[model samples]
Target: MTRHFSETEVVAILDDLNPARLRSFVAARVVTPLQTPQGQAFSEADLARLQLLCDLSEVYDLPDDALAMVMSLIDQLNTARGDMRALIQAVATEPDEVRGRIMTHVRSIRVTGRG
Candidate 1:
């Protein structure tokens, strides 16, 4: 079973995080937690994201909007990486000739800067 953290526990875990800021982050949709009968429950992923947000805010002094934009870009990049991994796995299952052809096409696109 996955361990879920309450808001109080999350605040205690992250040094730079406070109740007000956590609430603000949630309000901004930066760190979404699961709602349960007990109240908001944070996953490990949420904990890591909260840490990252604290770093971004403290180190870069980013406003909420800027943080949201940065987070969105990060999320998009992660999605693209997952998609690329899936494509690579699919290509790996192909015959050698097909794989070679695909690699050649990819190299040509890279060389021509067309992709």
Candidate 2:
């Protein structure tokens, strides 16, 4: 099972992320945590993201709007990568003839720069 960190524990791990900054991240929709009756709990993914956010904030000095845009783009790219993996797996199951056709079409598109 994946480990979950409480709000306090997250702050402890990331010293730079004080309570207020963590709250700001949540408010900005950058690092979302799970809400439970006890309180908020962050998963490993959230922890990694929060760490990245802290690094970006400290190292790059990015403005709030710019940071949000960067994070949003990263999220989109991750989603696209997952979709690409699924598509590749689906294509892998095709018969050799079908796969050959797909390869031909793909190579044609690449060479001609058209679909």
Candidate 3:
């Protein structure tokens, strides 16, 4: 089972995080936490994102809007990576000739800089 942390636990775990900052993050819709009967619940992924947010804020001193944009780009990149993984798996299931043809087309596209 995935471990979920309470708001308090999250604040405790992240050294630079405070209640006010966390509230701001939630308000900005940057780091979304699960709303449970007990209160807000954060997953491991949320924790990692929060850590990254903190690092970015400290390093770049970016505003909420800029941070959100950067996060959005990161999300898109991750989704594309996942899609590519699925595509690779699907292609791997094809017969040798099909795979060879696919590779040839891919190589030609790369070499000619065309789709």
Candidate 4:
């Protein structure tokens, strides 16, 4: 089962996560914790993200807009990495001839506008 952290627990774990800052993070959609009847329950991922947000806010002194942009770029990079991994796996499944052809096509595309 996944472990969940209450607001107090989150604050305890991350000293920088004050109530006001937590509210701001929620408003900014930076960390979407699960809402229970008790209160907001954060997952491990949420906690990690919150820690990063804290670092960005305190250390980098990034404003909300700038932080959002940085996070967006990070998300995009992660997505691209996953896509590249899947593509590599798919390529690995192909025959040697097919792989060679694909490499040639890729090289040609890099050298010229068209493959």
Candidate 5:
């Protein structure tokens, strides 16, 4: 059977987050923890994501707005990755010399102050 995490377990996992920030995340509905009449519960994914958020917010010192921007960028990157997967399916192989030539040209352009 699959396992979900409890709120306390989630809290314990993300020891870097302040209670106030955690509560704010709850209030923001960034993660929808399961809740009973007594209290809220969480999934393992929620715990993991909370830990990641704490790392960004505490260790990286990102403000809430900056975190939101980072999340938006991540979503965009995920979508781009999906698109890239589909595009790569059609490619046979990239020639190494061709790739190296493009890189060399790009470097030469940069050195010569050209776009």
Candidate 6:
């Protein structure tokens, strides 16, 4: 099981966000985590997401709404990737032309259904 981060650990991981950026992300509701009795609780995943937001801020000069849209698209892409990884692994285990044939058959099935 994944270990939950303590507040100190969370701060250590997230301290890369300078005070100004941290305020911006919090204001944008992009840095929210579960509040625990001791302190704020952030999943490790949030660290990665925050890093991506920081990168977007640096590279693209993304405003709040644009950053939100980019993050939303990132979520969509990540979901698609998870689905595709299993498919890709299955395809890799197949014989060389088998994958191609499967794609061909799928296309044919779709074409027939459309007709």
Q: Name the top TM-score candidate.
A: 1
CA lDDT, candidate 3, residue 72: 95
Off by over 4 Å in 5: 34-39, 90-115
TM-score of each: 0.97, 0.92, 0.96, 0.90, 0.58, 0.64
Error of 3 at 5 (Å): 1.1
Candidate 1 Cα misplacement greater than 4 A, ranges: none
Each candidate: what lDDT? 0.97, 0.92, 0.95, 0.91, 0.71, 0.77
| Tens-digit lDDT track of model 1 for 51-85 | 99999999999999999999999999999999999
C-alpha displacement of 96 in model 5, angstroms?
19
Ranking by TM-score: 1, 3, 2, 4, 6, 5
Report the poorest 10 consecutive residues by lDDT, candidate 1: 106-115
- Greater-TM-score candidate between 3 and 6: 3
Tens digits of lDDT, candidate 2, 1-115:
9899999999999877899989999988898899989899999999899989999999999866778999999999999999999999999999999999999999999999999
Scored against the true structure, residue 110 in model 6 reaches a CA lDDT of 96
Q: Give the TM-score of candidate 6.
A: 0.64
Measured with C-alpha atoms, the lDDT of residue 65 in candidate 5 is 72
Q: Write the per-residue lDDT of candidate 3 for residues 3-71, one digit (tens) a residue.
A: 999999999999989999888888899999999999999999999999999999889998899999999
How accurate locally is residue 93 in candidate 5, as Cα lDDT from 0 to 100? 62
Which parts of model 2 are misplaced by more than 4 Å? none
Which candidate gets the maximum lDDT versus the true structure? 1
CA error at residue 59 for candidate 6, angstroms: 2.2
Q: How accurate is candidate 5 locally (lDDT)?
A: 0.71
lDDT tens digits, residue span 31-105, model 6:
686777876666778778878888888888889988888888888999999999989898989997998898888
Instruction: Give model 5's TM-score versus the native structure.
Output: 0.58
Model 2: C-alpha RMSD to truth? 1.2
